[model samples]
Structure formats: structure tokens, C-alpha cells
Target: MIKKSELNRMADVANDRGVTVWVEFEGRRYGVTPPAATPPLDDTEESDLDRELEAFKAKNGYR
Candidate 1:
């Protein structure tokens, strides 16, 4: 299992490699800048899209 600190570290590494990490908590959204990158989407947007996709898959009976 990955600890939160480890995950955060990985996020940092990813940022160094041109990736960014977005995290969500308590219905609020926040973003962290990597050493040299930006997150693809804000947490709320990502969460919304994820929810929509899951709903679509469920509607289509996609197991």
C-alpha cells in the first residue's frame, strides 16, 4: 500500500517529469504544482467527469 507521503512524493516526481497532481478533500478542491508542470484538471472537474463516466457505464450495464 502507498502511504500518503509516498503518494505525495510520487506526485512530486511526476511533476518534475512534466506532470502535476490534483487532490480533493472535504468537498473542496486544491492543486499542487509539480517541480515543473501543471495538473490536467482541477479536482472538482476531474471528480465531475469521473462521476459522469461511471454513471454512463452503469447506465450501459458496463461491468
Candidate 2:
């Protein structure tokens, strides 16, 4: 079995490069890839969502 520290290092490398990382164990090869970067929400859309959230929070009496 691979050590926890080694697995963490592999994950770090994959995230830094935004590429797939693979490892072999027993007779099988396993791989992991970082998720694609999501585009930022438009300013107007974000503001509208924020307003909606605030309204919901107020209605629910959440601070």
C-alpha cells in the first residue's frame, strides 16, 4: 500500500499542473486529475444572486 504522504504529494503535483496523475498498485493503474477551472460569474449576475440571497436570509431571520 502507498503511504499517505506520497499520495498527498502526487495530488499536489496534479493540481499544480492541471494534469492527470497516475499510480500503479498491484496490477492496476489509477489516475486522478484536477477539476477544470470554472469561469467567474458575471458581475451583474453575482450582484443579483447576492441580493436574492440577502432577501432569503432576511425572510428566514438568519444573520
TM-score per prediction, in order, is 0.37, 0.64
Please provide, for model 1 over 1-63, each residue's C-alpha lDDT reduced to its tens digit, 9 standing for 90 to 100.
336886788677666776656556677655555663455878999899999999999999996
- Compared with the true structure, the alpha-carbon lDDT of candidate 2 equals 0.91
Q: Tell me the lDDT of model 1 at 58.
A: 100
- Candidate whose TM-score is highest: 2
- Please give, for residues 1-63, the per-residue lDDT of candidate 2 as tens digits: 988887888889899998899999999987878878999989999999999999999999999
**lDDT (Cα) of model 1:** 0.72
Cα-based RMSD of the predictions, in order?
16.3, 3.8
Which RMSD does model 2 reach against the true structure? 3.8
